[model samples]
Target: MNHAGPSPVPSIFPQFFAPGNGPTDFIVQDFAVVMIVAAMMMAITYKLKQPMVIGYILAGIVIGPFTPPFSLIKEADTLNVLAELGIIMLLFVIGTEFPMARLRTMGKISFAVAIVESTGTLLIVFFAAQALGFSFFDSLFLSLALSITSTVVTIKVLEDLGWIKSKSSTLVLGMLIVEDIFVVTALAVLQSFAAGGGEFSLPGLAVSLGVTGAFIAGVLVLGSRYIPRIIDRAGKTNDYALLLIVILGLAFGLSFLSTGIGLSSAIGAFLAGVLVAESNSAAVARILTLPLRDMFAAIFFVSIGALMNVSLVPMFIIPAAILILTSFASKLLIITGVLVRAKFDNVTALRAGFGMSTARGELSLVVVKGGQDVGAVSSTILPLLGVITVVTTFLAPYVIRFGNKITLTETKKSDGSSNMEESSSGVG
Candidate 1:
């Protein structure tokens, strides 16, 4: 009964290339499915005159584990990692376009819109969730999650519609920046609350905020002073490959540093981009990075769809619908009202409102996940949140188009009035 078996031989080759079953085989298979599904869906959406972002998301849902007929992709976690890469790339590109000077110019109006929108949305959403039978913690989390807008979705749609550099877009982008700051503070406060077993911790909150503020100021001051000079030197080399490598390094390097400090990688990547933009080689970097950004952005949107649980939609349909309605109304009305009160033209204000109301994207998921980790959010609310996110994302492009039509009509009317006035003056 003491028969000894021969010890299994350890392979010298890498596991990725092993025979019979390779460790990375599933990754390749999943990636292939994602690309094929995404291509088909994007084509369909393109033909229908819709933003390709919608198509990407639809493709994701089709191959997603939550979808019926069985999951086509076997490695969702791997795909999600790629999606994070997509977010980093997209935001990095956006950051390149927004220099610190432009950001400073946006301070006054941007602050007003951000403050009003966040405070109003938080209060309204909190009360609405409470009325819908949500527990206090659930309502608090939901309100916090919903108060912020999706920077990726809004900016992507703006890029799709060729409004990325418009006046309204500038204002919207600035407001988003301020909202992101708010998100950082909110998360810190929530974490403090969690750490203290539901009791508020003012000192912890203060420290978190202080650290965050310091980190941002430090990066902007230090990076803006040094990173651009390094990029300029690399640009003088006239080597495309070298320039690209340098830019990529800065983007990812700063992103990693941000994550190390408990901040979002997107913010770090953006800061890196801003620094790079200050260099003479900014044009070359943007040109070299566009393809990579587009590819990653598509994957990011797809991953968002995959994360949704369509099966739970039926269970939380009512709650989701109520929340969606309340959120959309509050964001649209509050943002537009604030912009108008600040003396912005009605068309621009309306466009900004529509842009901001697009959806809850990556950040909401992060917020809810954080809450869950701390035992503050219930599993039941996730399905409802998913439903709300999906609906809003799907509706964003259409809303933007509607706003565009309104803008066009107004412009034409204004132009015609000017022309008529000129003719009358000439006749007199």
Candidate 2:
């Protein structure tokens, strides 16, 4: 007591004494944890010859709130914001791959396949959802949710399977573009319906479509003219950083513009990419922005995984299982038939169908989330969708790989025709 209570104890960690707690610490910690876990899982999957997407999603599940261990993420909103950025960047990259000429070339067949497949999926899923006892609105929302395929996941799967340059791959990409357009239109109708403006508000729907069409036209006409000129001038400086900044600025600027007009930011970012791609600087810009696109894209998938609510899965197991099975089968059949009708060979049609069947990831998530936000979809649908997406995404790569193997065999058979010609010429 006389010695001042044996001296005051000094703590080893002094950073705690700095200031008031804020989001910075939480964000840093959460991000570090997510990245570390994701990296480790990715390594494990690589050793097993699996896609990195599975690892990223599993990493999210490990640290997510639904898991047994306590959640490590304290700033979910920050993660969401980053995920949104990832979406924009991903779409921007996709847009860069499609110039106006390419779009025009792919338009007819792509639109045919997309319209048939999407409409077929919607009708099938709608009736199936109703048979499963969902309400009219819920069935409508669910059908829409499952209609649009996940362009990101499908492309990743195709690339991983080494089929990215195949004829079917081209059709798949084209179909995705068509689906994106349909999704924009569907979202507008859904928003109107959710607001109690009736299921088919002629005036509202017309206005929405008109605005969207005008925006696209304007971007293609004006942006194609100006953006390339600006990028060319900027590229003359030969500064990689400056080129990247300009590209990103255009991407984000267009994304913001799209959102302001009630369209998806992804569409705008894509258009921006398309404009930039028309420029001579496209190659340089793609190379410079690749890393940023990849990094954020990983975060986006992880955030999707983090949103999974495992406990709710058991509540709708029967319906979810049915929906997944029927949705996959129907889409596969519909897409295959459409491709065949469009003059694609049997193997190519089947391959395209299989690839398209695995398209229930990001776009489905958007539809479901939009419905929930507007009170048109029930909270119960979230986990069901999460489970369906995970299952389909995990299976997609294998399915595509199998299809590729079959296509390769068909190619070899076709090559045999060349041998027949050679033999006939020698005999002659």
Candidate 3:
């Protein structure tokens, strides 16, 4: 038995690769097949009344670095890129739910809670990393990555549960938007530090902030005036009016330009949505994208599944788990603290808290990508983020369902208040 010149490298999955070959074969077979297996599992699990998101993640695990059936998808960079597009559309849809007035009426609580919650988790993770002896850059990456909450998931769940018209929904959406802004800021700062030897430069930072802001404002202003006409005219003739050529052209183009101004292209995309949200074309945009959003969005989720590497699991498992719990706690604390003091019931406060827990979109991905680009985090961070997004998105529906029940069951009939009995916002 001890006659071996060199021992075998004990593989996690032997059949998918040639004992040390690449995952090149998996792509040639089509990533759709990989997704099909994951989807099948999701369907079976969903029918059994389980959280199907977990199934997707588990599918990733099975098809990841460990399982033996299919391991040829490790080279799915193209799939990931499409999935990234999915992120933009995901936020686009989420923004459609927020409209401009909701942000204004929600008050500083929305903005304040987002800042408090994000900073709170950020500091905790940052300090924890420092205490654990991580370097400054590593700590920064860990902190930013850990603090993000899935705004897309939060809004989607709320919409699905029919709670988007409620007060807690308003707070959640406002704060989630705030959180999105924060994640963008964090990524920008990370990018600046990564650019080279300068610790801080006012001109660079200001230009970055100013340019991005101006771009957003300009798009919002210009888009508001022109987008409706474009939509209306195009609808009569183009037949593809919902996907406005001018708006799409501007959204992607401006989004590219926003990068020069220190903002993620996502801000441009979101602003594109905000502009339409304020105009007559908002319903048209929403109505058109509903089906396409579903299709592209699934590709996005499956692409995330395709990226999971079980090898990286050993490193991210603890961090991912820690970040998940801490992020949820921080959101809960800040939103609840702000609302409870404002004289809201515990149940409503808690629902507002749960709604703030989702943090999927360009912001979170940007953080991870920025970290990798800066050498602040490992390349594996990207796949881990994919895992996080898939897991959280899949779990969002249940959290939303529970939150609705908690808020509804705990609140009594309205007693002369202007706020609707089932609604959480005064505007609604």
TM-scores for every predicted model: 0.78, 0.83, 0.73
Tens-digit lDDT track of model 2 for 26-48: 67766776778778888898898
- The lowest-lDDT stretch of 10 consecutive residues in candidate 1 is 419-428
- TM for candidate 3 is 0.73
lDDT of candidate 1 at residue 27, scale 0 to 100:
78
Off by over 4 Å in 3: 1-31, 34-38, 50-70, 133-138, 155-167, 185-189, 192-198, 236-238, 241-247, 260-263, 357-366, 373-376, 383-428
Q: Which stretches of candidate 1 lie over 4 Å from their true place?
A: 1-20, 133-141, 151-174, 180-199, 344-351, 359-386, 397-428
Tens-place lDDT per residue, model 1, 1-428, is 11122212223334643557654787776677777888888889878876576687678777777776567666668666766687678768867876787667776988888888988998999999999899888898888889888777788788888888987788888888888657645764565466456755678667766766787789889888888989989889999899889999988998788767665666677778788788888888899999888788777767766755666669788888888888888988999998989877777788788888767766675566556546787766755776676678778878877765553322236446521111112101
Model 1 residue 88 distance off true place after TM-score fit, in angstroms:
2.4
What TM-score does structure 2 among the candidates reach?
0.83
Model 3, residue 112: C-alpha shift (Å): 2.6
- Which residue ranges in model 2 land beyond 4 Å of their true spot? 1-19, 134-141, 188-199, 369-376, 404-428
lDDT of 3 at 95: 58
